[model samples]
Target chain A: MKGLLLKDFLMIKGNVRSVLLFLVVFCLIALEGNDFLLFVPALISFMMFMTTFSYDEYNKWDPYAITLAVKRKEIVFAKYLGSFILLFFSLIITFLVALGIGIYNQNFDLQKTFTLLLGCGASILFLQDIVYPLFIKFGVEKGRIGLFVGIFLLSFLLGWILKNVSISIPQDIYSFVVSYLPWILAVFLLILTIGSYEISKKIYTKKEF
Target chain B: MKKILEVKKLKKSYGDFVLGPVDGSFPGGVIVGLIGENGAGKTTFIKSLLKILQAEGEIQFFSNKKEDIGVVLDNSFFPEILTAEDIHKIMKNIYKNWDSSLFFSYLEKFSLPKNKAIKNLSKGMRKKLEIVTALSHHPKFLILDEPTSGLDPVVRKEVLDLFLDFIQDEDHTILLSTHITSDLEHIADYILFLDKGKVVLEETRDVIMDTYGILKCGKDEFSKISKEDVWRYSESRYGYEILVKDRDKIKKKYPNMIVDKITLEDLMVFVVKGRIL
Candidate 1:
């Protein structure tokens, strides 16, 4: 596991643009008057993780990786964990910078902004949990296209539902959903990820090269 | 002797090309050369053994009491950005017996700078890096596909020597596939030749070397030998040159036949695409 992590870091180190983009987004979010930019860093981090994985897949290194003694379970977990770690750190930086910007601007509200940022971050994690399995099962090329398209369509449909429905009953629905959705999605996708790992293991074991 | 690697009735299909239900085995302490022309299922066979493609077969591996096999292929293991050190770390997690010290030592022996990224290295250096990592693990079996293809003779010789070092142990076994038959002629104990997705010849190197003979005969004398015995014959200014599988029979039948030593390449040509007499 340590070896796999070290290797991942080393390979990612070659792509300096990713880190630079992370920083650029972090700074951009810090300066934004609204809390919208906070979500950008997390989204970018997740996408960067996806991109790194895509690069690995394109080169056909997965079979060699499995031969190294690391189980399929660990490979999937490491990727998920790596993305989360990067997201966590990027959020912290964005939060701190946003706080600094709030103090500088003298009009920013820390409490409300932090709340929005947290909600957005959790939603990103939820989306990732669902998308990762697709990537694993179908590979990044077609899976990525399907993922983004699905997300866009789902978001659009949700927007249509929110806009058309005149039910004025629940103001706490956003917080309610945000609070429970990530946990539910995480547990469900964790199970799905495990199943994906088993499939990957079976596929790899049968593969000849 | 323990069986280091075995492949039984392995079959794989790629659209139009089909790699058979081919069965072969390699015992410990022997080097097996998998020789075939381009697109003759050499890579497919190696891939099948490594389980790199989905195939139906039984592949058993001995050594470390596990199916732990080392793979030394072309420059396809590490991506362009990862360094040797990075690869060392990655592989340590993959191989229970991965020895970092051994890996670095092999890298140093090859004069490969550990800090330099893989993409920056020359082709020969990249190949050396792949070999270093593949051999670092204490694997009992190795599947090397085209390890010596497209390299200068000097470097090829060096890599060949490394392969020799790999099988120095009595328990180690290797299936080295290449079109460069001469490189393996000296070390290979057994040779399996594949022509068109089929095993055309499978025998000990000594038997192959002993069996086939290139004979020089006058045009008139060529008529004396049986046409079935002639694998391929060529007409030259001096006379007729021919390849015969059963050289002893021909010599006994035609005592005046000028028989010469045949190389593995000669045998392959005659067996594969050689012009019939």
Candidate 2:
């Protein structure tokens, strides 16, 4: 597991210069915006995760990795671990940028801005959960359709949540729920992430290369 | 000799193309070559043995753990974006027995630059890098899938010598799949011939080279020999060229006939052209 992580880290390390450039550009833009700050880093990190698979597919490394003494399950786990680590790192960068903006703008809405950022982060993660398994089941070339489908579904879901999800509650209850919504959603995403891992593991185990 | 690896009733299928029911074992201390024509299931058989593709059968490795066997695949396993030093880091965590010093030594011997990414390396260099990676792991068994395909004659000879060096350890064994029958002729102790997804013949290299003979004779002389004695044969305007086993026995039976020794390439052509003789 450590080895797989290190392999991915090194692979991603090659893109660090571009990634830093990405951060600088997005960070500057983020400082001038609100919840939009979270969007750039999260998307870049997710795209970075996706690019690693293209590398894997181009080189046909999975077949070679399977030839190693490691267990089939560990190979699957490594990708999941690497992607999650990326998401987590970018999540921090995104959050810090969001906070820096909130601090800059004296009229900051902690509850609204934080919740919006959390929603964006959750959507990106959920997309990763689906995109990764699709990539694993069908290689990058074939999985491209699935990726498009995933992106469409993600956008549809985000749009649905923004417009259709409305609760008719008293002011006091609404305030209570809205204040704790990020925590509740965090736990929910954690469950989905585990379920996603299990699903990916099952598919990966029976896979040939 | 100890049997280091074994396969029993192994098989895989993709609609019409089926590979296997292959069963053979590599003895503990020798280089074994796997020979076959294109689409002869050579790659599939090795992939199945490694469990790269799911197949039905029992494949037992040297240490029971499949990891003890190192592989030099036809394609580079690490991303072409990675350098030798980068792969060294990746492999350090992948294999328990990966030896950095041995790996670097081979890299130097092969003249592979450590910092250069794989994409920049020539095909011959990539093959060399794969071999270097496979050898440095100190595996008890090495599974090579066309490990010397792009190499020059000089480099191929040097690599073949390296395989010889590996088998000197007594515990080391190799399963080499190659098109270069000449290389096998030089280094392989055993040859397993595959044709249309079947193990047509498995014999010691010496037995195939010394005992297996081609008896060039006329139709009348060929008819006298039993069909069971002939592995394969073809008729030409000149005469009938027959591949036969038990060279001494045939010599005794027909002292007037000539029974010339055969090479691995001739054996493969006979097996595939005649295809089940």
Candidate 3:
């Protein structure tokens, strides 16, 4: 598993120039005080993590890796672990960058920035949790299509709910929900990621080549 | 002889092709060359043995752990973006006994650049790199699929010599699948021939070279040969060519008939293309 993770990191390192260029561009855009700072870094990290699968497919590395002494489950687990590590580093970098920009602008809302960053990080994790299993079972190309359609449907459902229904919550209930939202989202993310790992492992274990 | 590998009732099916019911026990310290026509299941059999593909079978490797096996697949390897140096680093962690110095020595021997990405290397260079990686781990068994497919004759000879050196230890074994039958003729101890997913022939190289013969005769003379002795026969404009076992027996039985020594290529063509008796 360490070998596999190291390979993924090396693969990313091979394209470091392009990755750095993209980061620089995103950082400049993020300095405009837009909410892009919250999500762009997470999205960039996710994209970088997903490209490892593309590299694997291009050279048919999975079949070759299977011939090695590594277990099938370890291969799946490595991808998940690599993604978490990338996400962690991306979160820290984004926090620092947001802080620099916030302090420079003299309107630093530490609480709001933290909340939005957590929400964005959780959203990206949710996306990964759903997509990893799809990629494992159906491969990267088909999985990308599935991801787009899923995003479309989710947004459509959210739009319909907002447009058609208005709910009035008691002040106490609303306050309780708002205060516990981060904890709720964290727990949900944990369950979803674990379930995704289990599904991906099952798919990979039974996979031929 | 001590058996190094054994398989029984092994089978795999995908799409329209099915490979299977294969049974064989290969002896240790010998290089077993697997030969077949396209889609003859040589690659499939190798994959099944390595568990790269799911197949139904009983496979037993004597005195060898999974980690002790090295593999060089034909079309699969490291990602194209990775350099040879990166592979060395990755494999050092993957294999408990990976010898980094030996790997670098092999890279130097093959003239493979450490910093160049795999995509930049020539096809033959890539193959040499794969072989180098397989050898550095000190595996007890090596399973190679077309390990010398793209090399020039000179590199091919050097690679073949390397295989010869690897099996100097009587405990080591190699099962190589290749289209280059000439390489097998030079180094293979046993030939395992496959035709349409079945083991048509598996014999020691000495037995194959000494016992198998091609009998060239006219139709009238061919008619005199017993059907049991004719493994396969093909008719051309001038005469009929028959593949026969026990060349010396047939030669003694018919002193006037011409029976020439058979090569692996001749044997494969006869088995795959000639009419069965």
Candidate 4:
């Protein structure tokens, strides 16, 4: 696992300058005011994460990786863990940004902002659980289409709730759901991530080169 | 002699192509060359042995501890964007016995630039880096697929010398799959010849060189030699060039007949592709 992580770090290191540049440019534009900018770093990190898969496919690196002292299980775990690390950093930066926005507005509400950021981060990480397993089962080229479909569904679902469902709910009901929905979904996705890991292990173990 | 590696009925099939259901072994302290034609399952067999591909077989290697066995694959492994320095860091974490000083020495010796991205390096430089990385940790058994394929004669000779030097230790063994039979002629102690999916022949190199011969004689002289002694033959303007499996027997039977020396290239070409004339 250590070796795989080291290799991935080296893999990621080469792309760091570009990814960080994306973050820097998008971050400045975001500062003017757009909650969407918060996702730019996480999204770029996610794409960077997928590039590692392409690298493995490029020259048959995974089979060679296995010949080292590592196991297939460790390689699967590293992908999940590396993405988690990326998301975790994205959130930390998001948290600092949220705090700055709250301070500047002077209507600081820590609980409300944290819940929104947590929910957004959790949802992206959740999609990764499904998409990563798909990536493992198929190469990144096939998985790319599946990822976009999932993203469209998420957007449609969010649009529907905002346009139809949320408006119909009573004031108290809206507050209650908003206060607790992120926690509930976070727990659900955590269980699903475990399932993803198991499924990925089965696929990766059966894969020949 | 104690066996360093052994395979029993190893087999792999992909659609129309099949590899193995063949068997062979590498006893300790020798270099074994695996020679075959283009479609002859050389890469598949090597990949199967490394467990890189799923295959059916009983294979016991390096006492079943895979880390003690090093491998040089035909394709690239490390990401192309990373430099050799990055690989050094990655390998330090991968192998327990990875010797940085040794690896660095090879980098300097091979003239491989330390910081250049692998994508930018020429093919020969990339190959040297791969071989250097595979050999950095002192492995008991080494397996290489087409190790000398694209190299120029000079560097190929140097790399072959390095491989020959690697086996100076009595326990070190190498299983090299290559089409360049000439490379093996100088260093290989044994030759494992594969045709189609099966091992057509596996014998000590010295023994094969000493016993195998190409007999060149016209119709009258060729008729005198018994048919059973021939492995394969081709009709030539001068005569029939027959590859004799047991030159000593023919030499003894026809005292006046010249038993010529056989090159590994001639030996493989005859057995695998030649038709009996």
lDDT, candidate 2, residue A182? 77
- On DockQ, the candidate that comes out on top is 3
DockQ metric, candidate 1: 0.47
What does candidate 3 score in Cα RMSD to the true structure?
A: 1.6
lDDT of 2 by residue, B28-94 (tens): 9999899999999889988998888999988887687655788987664898888999989888887
Collision pairs in model 2: A69-B67
TM for chain B in all models? 0.91, 0.94, 0.97, 0.95
> Runs in model 1 with CA error above 4 Å?
A16-25, A102-114, A151-209, B63-67, B217-219, B231-241, B275-277
Kindly report the root-mean-square deviation of model 1 from the true structure over all alpha carbons: 3.6
Output the number of the lDDT-best candidate: 3
Query: Per-residue lDDT of A44-111 in model 3, one digit per residue for the tens?
Result: 88999999999998799998999887999999999999999999888887888788788888888889
Chain B, model 4, TM-score against the native?
A: 0.95
The runs of at least 3 residues in candidate 2 whose Cα sits more than 4 Å from the true structure, single-residue gaps closed, are A99-117, A150-177, B218-228, B275-277
Per-model DockQ against the true two-chain complex: 0.47, 0.68, 0.82, 0.68
Q: What lDDT score goes with residue B9 in model 3?
A: 97
* Model 3 error, position B97 (Å): 0.4
CAPRI tier for the interface of model 4: medium
lDDT of 4 by residue, A35-103 (tens): 767766667677777788888789688878877777888889988888888788877877777677667
Using TM-score as the yardstick, the better of models 1 and 2 is 2
